[model samples]
Target: MTLSRLACLLLAAAPLALSAPARAQAQGQPQGQASPAPGRTLRVAPHADLRTLDPVFASIVITRMHGLMIYETLFAWDSKLRPHPQMVESFSTSEDGLTWSFRLREGLRFHDGQPVTARDVIASLKRWMGRDTVGGKLAEYTAALEASDDRGFSLKLKRPTGMVPFALGSAVGQIPAIMRESDAATDPMKPVTDTIGSGPFRFNRAEWRSGARVVYDRNADYRPRAEPADGLAGGRVVKLDRVEWVIMPDPATAAAALQTGEIDIWEQPGQDLIPVIGRSREVRVERYSSLPNQAMLRPNHLYPPFNDPRARLALAYATDQADFLAAGFGDERWWKRCGSYFVCGGPNGTEAGAAGYAKPDLDTARRLLAESGYKGETLVLTSSYDIAHIGRMAEVAGEALRKIGMNVDVQFADWGTVTTRQANRGPVDQGGWNLFVTTASGATMQSPITNIGTNMACARAWAGWPCDEEAERLRNAVAEARDEAGRMAATEALHRRLAEMQPYRVLGQYDQPYARRANISGVLEAPVMVFWNIEKR
Candidate 1:
C-alpha cells in the first residue's frame, strides 16, 4: 500500500473532530485556566506517545522533550555548544580547583509554590549520577557533595577535571533535571511521577493521557535570564499560554492533520512524506540542526554470540552502512553514509580504524562467525513499529545478519513496549533482546566522553552492558588531555580501540527536518524540540 493512500484511508476512517485532540480536550484543563484562547494553545503532533515522564529512568527522546518543558538545569549548552549558567546565580572554585561552590538564583520556585533550594539540587544530581553516563563520570571524581545553606551548595572533588560543569549541563541522554527534594529522593531506577519544576512550563498532570495527549501550561512564576534566548540556554521566555502534544503514531494521519492546520508543528515528518507535505504553502519544512542524527545498531553484550568480540566484529563486517541509511531515509539529499562513530562532519569525526569494515565483506563475516563458536542460537532483534525509520533499519539489519548464516528472530512492538523489553537483562527466551536500533543527536555524538555508546562502565553503562578497562582508560585520556592537539590524538586512539571492542555499530547520519505551520515562529534551532520561545499565530 502506498503511503499517500494509507494516509487518505486513515484520515477517512478517523475524522479530526473525533481524533486524539478532541478526546484530550474533553478530559480537562489546568486548575485555574478553564479555557485557553485559540491562538494561545500550540498543538503539536509529536513522533511518539509520552509514556515515561521521568527522563532519568528512560533515555528516549520523547521523555527528554517532556522533561525539558517542565525542568530547568543549572547550566545549558548555548548555540555554540558552550556551557552557560541557567539556574546558578553565582559560582566559584578554589585555587586547587577541588572545591566548587554554587549558589542558586533567588525567586526560583517550583510549580507547587515551593522555593528551589540547594538541597533539591544536591539530591537531583545524586540521583542523576547513578543513571547518566556523564553523571557517572562526574561521580567518580566527586569527593563530597553537600548543601552549604538553603540556597547554596558545594562540590568537593577528589581530583580536579574539567567535566564538572559540562556534566551538569549536558543536553544529551538522561539530562540532570532539577526537581524538588522530595521528588529527587526517589530511587534512581524508579520513575518519579511528581512533575514540579522551575522551568518556563508546567506539566498538566490532570490533562495527561497515556496514548492520547500530553499538555503543559506556561509557568507564570518562571523568571527569565537577562540575556536573550540562545540554544537550550539564555532566557526561556514562554510566549504561548499552553502547549498540547497530541500523540499521533501514524505518519499519514500526522501529515494530514498538519496540512489541515489541526496541529501547529509536526516534530518528525517521515522523509518520504516530506516532498508531499512541502508542496503546501501553509507548511514549511525546516532543518533544526546542522549536525545530523546518527543511527546505531546496538548488540547485547551480556548474551551469547554478541558477547564474543569476534561475533560483534562479524556483524560489523557483514553489514553495510549505505543499506541502513538508504532503507531508513529514502532521500539521498537528507542522509549521508558515514563511518566515523563521532559523526563524520563534526570536529572529532575520524574514520581511523574503520577502513577494514568500511564496506561489507561476507567472507570475513562467515569466518568470524565460525571462530566465535556460535551454535546457531536464535538471536532476537527487537524494534518499534511505531517509528518508521527505526523499524525499517531493524528489518534491513535482520536480513543482512540472516544472509551471514545466523538464526535471527525479528520482533516488533510499540516504542514504549520495545524500550521496556530492552531494559530486561535476562536471556533471549526470557523476554531479553540480542539487538536493538536507536539514534542519538549529532550534538551529543561529537565528543567521545559524552557519547553513551563509548561508555564501558559494565553494569552501570547504557542498556547493552559493554565492559572494557582499556577503552575506559583511553576515554579518560581523551577527557584529561591538556590541549586540542593532545585531545585529537587521544580521541583517535580511543576510536581505534572502539573499532576493536565493537560496542555498537554506527549505521549513518541523516538530517531530521521539522514541519511546522507558516504562522508559528520563534522555533529555536536546538538538539531536541523545546516548547519555550515558540509562538503560534
Candidate 2:
C-alpha cells in the first residue's frame, strides 16, 4: 500500500538504559538469539521493500509498521478500524468545530527518554503542514496548531472540517515522532540519514540499498498501553527484543523463509501462495484484505475523449472486472464492485452501494462507446511497471476492456507520475496517451478532512467529464459542514456521485497475507500494521 508521510519527524530508540533482555515469550528461545531476551532481536523476511526510514517521510508497509514500534500516533485504529487513543488522553473541539483542543495524557516520554509535551506535538504537526513535507494530511484546513502549554495543544482550522482528527489515522498523521518546527526550518531533513520517532522500538539503521531491510531495537525508555491497540489486537508487548526487516522482493522467497523458519513473520504473501500456505499446519494465513486504502481507478478527465461521460462510461462498461480479477488475482475473493469511494465498513459505510454497483453489461458498454465518439482510437492505460502482479493486472485490465470494444493501449510506468497526469488530464489536447490508473491506500481516512480542493474534482475541472458539478458542490459542503451529521451526509452524497459517475473502472483492494509460526501470539491485524502490539509465542 502507498503511504504519504510528512517529513522532519521523530523516530524511536534509546541506548541510555539497557537491562538484560527478557524473553518476550515463555515457550521458546528468543526470536534471534540462543537465549531468549524480551528485547532480543527478531528477523523478518518481507515481500515488499521498506521505502524509507525518515520518521516523517517513511510511511510504506515495512517502514511505517516498524516505525510504530518507534514513533507514536495521537490515535490508532484497531483490527475493526475502531479508534484507540494513544498519545492524547481526551480531546475536544470548539462549538464551531474549527478549533480542536487536545488534552494529552501526562507522563508520556519519547524513546530517547525525552518528556513528550504539547510543545513537541505542536512542533511535529506544524512542520508536517508547513510544506509538501512527509507524514502530513491536514495541510489544507490547518491555519494554526500550537501548544498552549506542556500538556495542552490547540489547532485552528481554516474552516469546519469534521474529518480532522480522523485524518491523523493516515500515514502522514502517524509519523516522525515530534520535533521543533524552528529546528527543522534551519536544517531540513535529508533523504540520506535515518529519521527519529517515539515508539516501542527505535531506529538502529536504514540501508535502503541493502535491499530495504531496516533493523530496530526496543527503546530502553519505551512503554506500552496495557490496553490492546484494538479489539482485533488483544493485549500485546514489543516481542522479540530486536527486529530485522530483511528485504525479499520475491513473495515465493519470503514464503520459503517462513516455511524454513528463517523468519518468524511474513507481512505480504503472494496470491498464488495464499491457498497453499494456509493449508500448511506449520503456518497460518491471516487474510488481511484492504490492508491499504481503497484501490481506485481515477479518470483522465482532462483529455478530449475522456471529457465526455459517454466516453468515461464506455470505458467503465468495457471493463471486464471478472477477467481482470481472475488474471491479476487467482480468486474473486478480495475484489469488490464498490459503488462508493470507501470500503464496506469505512467511515462512509452504508447499504447504499450494494444496490447501486454490480457487474458489467457489455451491450450497454458498447452502446456508450459508440455514442461517445470513438472511431476505434487507441486508448492508453498508464500503470506501475514494478510490483509484478499490478503490472500484470494492468495488462489484463487493458485486454479485458478491449473485449468490450475499447482500443486499449497499456503503458507501464511509476504510479506517482501516472496519478498526477491522470488528475490533471482533460480534452483531446494530444499527449502520449489517454487514461491513467490512480491508486490510494495505506490507511483508513475520512475524505472531508484529508483530501484537498486540488484533489476534489478530477483536478479542479469539476464541470467536465465523469466528475460533474454536483460532486464539486457536495465536496465543498462536506468540507464546510459545521456538524458531523451534515458533513457525513455530504460525504455520502459525494461518494454516491462517484459511483454514479463511475469515474474509473474499480479494480479492487490490495489484500496482504500475514503468516506466523503456530506458537506465535499477539497478531495486530488492521489496515495499518502496528508491530509493537506483537509478541512472540
lDDT scores in order: 0.87, 0.55
> TM-scores across all candidates?
0.96, 0.73
Weakest ten-residue segment in model 1 by summed lDDT: 23-32
lDDT of 2 by residue, 55-86 (tens): 45332344446556566667765665555567
lDDT of 1: 0.87
Backbone clashes (count) for model 2:
41
How displaced is residue 84 in candidate 1, in Å? 0.2
TM-score of candidate 2 relative to the true fold: 0.73
